[model samples]
Target chain A: MKGNSYLSRKLHSLLGVIPLSLFIITHALTNFSAVEGGSERFKAAVGFINGLPLVNVLELFGIFIPLIFHGVYGLYIAYQSNLNTGQFSYGRNWAFALQRISGVITFIFVFWHVYQTRFQVAIGGITHDQLGMTMHNIATNPLFFTLYVIGVLASTFHFANGMWAFLVSWGITVSPRAQRVSSYIWMVVFVLVSAMFLMSLSAFRGDEFKEAAAALDAIRTIV
Target chain B: MAETTVAKKSIKFVITRQDKPDSQPYKETFEIPYRPNMNVISALMEIQRNPVKDDGNKTSPVCWDSNCLEEVCGACSMVINGKPRQACTALIDKLEQPIRLEPMRTFPVVRDLVINRDRMFNALKRVKAWIPIDGTYDLGPGPRMKETKRQWAYELSKCMTCGVCLESCPNVNERNTFIGPAAISQVRLFNAHPTGEMNMEERLETLMSDGGIEGCGNSQNCVRACPKGIPLTTSIAAINKDTTKHMFKQWLGM
Candidate 1:
């Protein structure tokens, strides 16, 4: 009885890894589409995106509903484990700490992303897929570019780390050898996702690329 | 002053002794014939057999809790050489000369090495870390989960309630009533359950209250310190998202 609640709350948080991770992957793909036609193409993509009733409506339910459930469950489970398993200490406390921190980073990122793109387009009437044109706008502004790169990197790490933890919670990584192997696998996936996401961003930033390429060429000549 | 001898003599074990939970703790040193493979608990057992300190002082046997002997039960945890770990797993050979043992300070000392963990137990209770089934009648199979989701839930369940995590947590000190990482991860675990979704609103509301998830400062010490390797930091992050949505719902009266 008591155990069931504890398990259910934990499971909900674990399931969250799926939706969040999947959302990022889809987002990165959509952003990559900007590399073809730049701003105008990106705007068309945004129109297509906004037109997709299934995605927009589902996204509202997907992002918020699970997020709220996960939060409440996190609080409850944290307290419950504190009770039944009275052996509380730092070494035993780290895993939960990481899960929560990554959750915070992801949440902050989501809010900012939605504000910059979704809200802007809804209110200011965007001329392009503000979300997709992120690459172009970032290319124009170096500060935004740096922030974008960091944000994408952070998202990838959180997603991969979440996936690994989720797997452990689900009892998939059994045996010492298997655990190490799976960790390596998850690491590779994280790096790949991050690199691909960054690549797409860099590709669309045509002017930034030209400047960076010139700097590299100068360094090559000097060295 | 101590002197070194080259002779093939056995090592000595000087252990603290206590009877009941309310009794005063005392020290009793034992000179056990040097055995290569031995632990604090093993040496204590030897002393228990002879019931004599090195100075020929007879005393009551030492007592502690230990199970699995493999470091999983976390019952035999104690301070060895100024660090917390299982006495059963702490081998004599790996320890420095005159190994020192003491009860974990975070908990109330029960006897010699045993301490009361009631505080932590109460913390878990405060969070209501369990699913309410409503009855003893067997409710045939709950909602099914996709394979991917099931795998992750198993990972969060690996927590064994070892206090080492809390011992290392800075937030879990006397100054704060922070519930710590174990409970937070457990919240992530149960909230992931199929039927558990129903009570999600209730759980998020709890975090919004005093001494809840807001206490976390993003120190990230809990992730590196957990022995079970549970993803605590990630759980903390996931909850942040949950809380924000919850807060939004409250704003609109949802």
Candidate 2:
């Protein structure tokens, strides 16, 4: 029973980095295309992903299943942590507490973001081409925009800090100096990834995305 | 006149006190005449002798455990000025005013500053943190270790089981069974020994269980808070690698 938990804990750490972290990186890149080449490029990126053979299979195994396991097990781990940052106010101590806090935040944000987009599509509420329009609607709403910003920041921080823990637990960064260097690298990652997500959000609020969505709607009406 | 004025100056101490194992803890302030080069132990002794509160009321002597006044003996571990360390080494001159002394709550507190360290000892037992040898037969000379290896291993041997590493860890509290960092590092120390390596697989197996190596959250606080300057996080990482291999070996039925 104990050995089972050991494997499960390691698997939790591994899954966070392997498919989940990779998915976050790719998802950010796909979103960032909106900022770089307007809604057309964003649509193309989304279309390219949706058009892939075995896309549903990939989503199930690569994204949804891993996400559920990581998110649920992460909540358990968070519950087990005894946060004592008040007494031990060291930087790493704060980071430990924040890791758990951000894990919960990211779990909520990811689920809500998915429900707003993918689940909406499943129910035939919107077409894949209207993803940019859906994002635009979200980004322009004051409450949802604020929530997205907080969610994006929280998710990025969780990933970056989690990567640092992953390196240590997996025996990659063994020495203090290596751990110190790894922290700096991960902080940079946090900033860069956060910038990518924020820029994409801002792009959704742009007039070009509205025009693109309107054009897509017009073509649908004509058809 | 200057000597008289210096004699009047006093040091203030705020100690968290509990009358019994199950009693609620409370704070008591004491003022003792200033002395140069005085450590926390000496101040505590002053309070014990006089047994007077800052309010000028008589009280029972504060109880604490100590053997060697030096930092070598791990018995005098406590939280001083919000850091878990040896009270013997916490210099009054270096500490902030109103030096706060509290029992290390990571273990169950027996009295004022005395805590039961059985949890740490039990963790050591769980990991079998010792080299086995039969006493009946004359075991011949042990295999020699390389000088370089001995040097690093000596650093690990300095651990007095003071429980400071455990006290500083956020994961080693009442809510969880995590064995904390001290025992994990001990496993690393003993496993490296020539004779001790005989039971290396057994130790690694223990580390793969509940309240074992996987319990570490990699907060890195234990390494920072260790008074003996042991490379604890390094040991944990080494153990993690070893456990990974062990887990695979078991999975492959090897």
Candidate 3:
């Protein structure tokens, strides 16, 4: 295959940084809010987001379009690129491979997450209380919990490592010292975002949400 | 027994041949009387003397390029038994039967075992992969590199632009404009020179542009594939760091 086009590379880099990463960081922080203030706060945050004017448009153009392009283009790059970590497994080489792997995992997880939750909300079949309760019930399932943990890990690593790559690829942190410094910063982000995801998941595991989920199940059965 | 040994001593070759650019490639087999310690270049020369197919048909002599019949010139680089390397160093007895030879596809195939390496040269030009001290008068002795630095720089200096690394690089194909690892490593070499440092920013700027360092996907294959054993991936990592610093310098308006 021919080399990457200027426009494609530029757009890929740009999309990763802009709306996509911005949304990811925000989503992580919002999830952390669930841990900070419980299901009521989580419901308020989700409701505010779901209730925002033109939120559908924002999700479509701001998040989904850019995300799809970044992901598809990333796969194209990964295909055009060779993997040789078997012989030359340097830190950067491993990171390069992990970046692509995590990108794929994150891509699948994002779509599945949206399909499971947001799509239901869009169809008016799920309310804010149900959102929290559904998440609580799903978290109780060992398989779903494991998948969620893996999904969160993949996304956190992808975003953090993607930031590191963007720095060098864009010529932002050219010096080894500067890159090392930036790497330290990205490591912190990795740890923090990962903690945020775990904390959010723990909030879903709480007994309060478990009781709410049980009550909702009883109501559904009766209805 | 001597006559049987003599009759059995023949080198078999399976060569990929393309009559012209844009033409389909076909395979041709040739059997040449073996010589002791014969490299691929000498074997090809023996075939050139006969210019006949193994089946006793008169056909055109096999086409390939070489100079310095030693591995230094890098002109004789081609795929020998599925590996991109110099034919001048590939000995017949060291290779498997029916040794396969093909032109490096990283560059456009010109004819039979020859390819145009203009892509690499163009990249060198783009990165200004040289020192700029041209003058008629005698120039003063340049600054010396530290002994430790000289050792590795000497190693980096061995790249012959053989296109072997490019051929093995997945990112250097026809669809991608990645200048490949050879050029990026050369940038590391040039930027290390005392005089070459004068144009370091310009070189880094070129590397920061399209099809430059950004195109590298860090496959790490270049270092493994390099016939000269240049530290390609290390150079790329080093230059990657350099370009990032250069960008910061530009941002600081330094």
Candidate 4:
């Protein structure tokens, strides 16, 4: 097993899609709910997730643990890659290089994002209901807003491009035509997912969210 | 006047040369009288005969490996004008002027334009990329393949082990032991055969090891780089599936 990195590599690919990708989709949709149905809707979505039976266990095994392995191992893989896209300039070659680049960006962004939101909740610095207010504050800052935009783009690209690699490596798309089709499909996924995320970001800065954040702050002051 | 000028036309070559395997490489330029439909190999031959630089200095003849004088042999694979292909088929008419010839640096340079292809041969051996027929006694009329399967498999069989696929692959360089694309495609070719199917599991096991099928980053440069147009990525994807199934079978203790 010393020289055999096969199982580990496959596990990395598997963990990327199984819980990680699934988690990302749910997360984007949940955030989009803030814009679609406003703060109350976003609260209900978070509440429903947090209220699930054995929610802590689910988060630990389903999201956090898998995420740690995927991110840490992904960093190792990114480091191992010797990108020659400058010389090659092939479409897949650029995808290969961009995949690793986006992985690194997404990893850092995800770490900071989880720390700013989820970790803050865990540490009692902000309650679950105050998540909207917290996001509002972050989104209003021009620098943070720009960072969030870049982060969302990188994360979506990583997920979508990763999905393409996963399909091919798992033997789902075995032919060149199948691979070409798969790439086009994933490109669409990247665009749609990125749009969803960016929409949520803009929603945070909306008047409705600002009013809701103000109401939350007023109640907190009164209490 | 135009006929004489056309007859006196010449091609310029800028070739990288190394005196020894461990020595640094240097560039030498040569101008050769061009002929119609002459390929890179022919120009190199003219240089070999003259052994003179464009600067009118006497020099050593350029060295390269080639056989079959056709694309069939994997030999004579060198980087011509920044692309990896066989010099035998790289017609001078098609290439840009002052054509740069260099060794396919993926493999160690033995001399000018000659690379030691032991890595590819080792990869083939590692995968046991052949049917294990007993040659001591005659084994006649082995299992036959379906015409449809044989049609595609025949396309895969055109691999000359030219090392171009390896040269084009980012993962098959000095930092990693990636067995590269050619041998992986060869595995698909052999494993599809009736007699060859016997050792399919063994071959898959090797692919499951380090520097095996797992090394493919899916950059997909191999398929495009292959002069024969072998479906390298398709074979890689197929082998990826096989190895996954094989891993499960091993886990199940079957």
The candidate that achieves the highest DockQ relative to the unseen native structure: 2
The stretch of ten residues in a row with the least summed lDDT in candidate 3 chain A is A1-10
TM-score of each: 0.51, 0.96, 0.73, 0.95
Chain B of candidate 3 achieves a TM-score of 0.94
Model 3 chain B weakest lDDT span, ten residues long: B1-10
Provide the global lDDT of candidate 3 against the true structure: 0.83
Model 3's number of clashes is 15
Model 1 per-residue lDDT tens digits across residues B174-213: 6555677777777777789888766777776676565666
DockQ of each: 0.03, 0.71, 0.26, 0.69
lDDT of 4 by residue, B73-145 (tens): 8899999988899999999999999999999988999998889999889989999998998788898988889
Q: lDDT by residue for model 4 over A67-106, one digit each (tens)? A: 9999998887877678878768999999999999999999
Query: In candidate 1, which residue ranges exceed 4 Å CA deviation?
Result: A1-4, A7-11, A14-18, A67-98, A125-135, A138-143, A168-182, A208-223, B1-76, B81-91, B97-102, B105-108, B117-254
Candidate 3 per-residue C-alpha lDDT over B109-192 given as tens digits, one digit per residue, 9 for 90 to 100? 999998999888999999999898889997988888788877888888999988988877667775666888988888899888
* Per-residue lDDT over A163-187 for candidate 3, one digit per residue giving the tens place of the 0 to 100 score: 8777766656655577679879998
Off by over 4 Å in 4: A1-3, B1-7, B135-140
lDDT (C-alpha) at residue A99 in model 3: 82
Which candidate number would show the highest lDDT if scored against the true structure? 4
Best by TM-score: 2
- Give the per-residue lDDT of model 2 (tens digit) for B1-254: 45554337799989999999999999999998888899988988998889999999998888988888898989999999899999889899999999999999988989999999988888899999899987899998889888998898899999999999988888887666677898989999999999998899999999888778877887878998999999999999888877887888988999
Flag clash pairs in model 4. none
CA lDDT scores, all candidates in order: 0.65, 0.90, 0.83, 0.91
Once fitted onto the true fold, the runs of candidate 2 whose alpha carbons sit more than 4 angstroms away are: A1-3, A219-223, B1-7
Q: How would the candidate models be sorted by TM-score, starting from the highest?
A: 2, 4, 3, 1
Model 1 lDDT at residue B149? 82
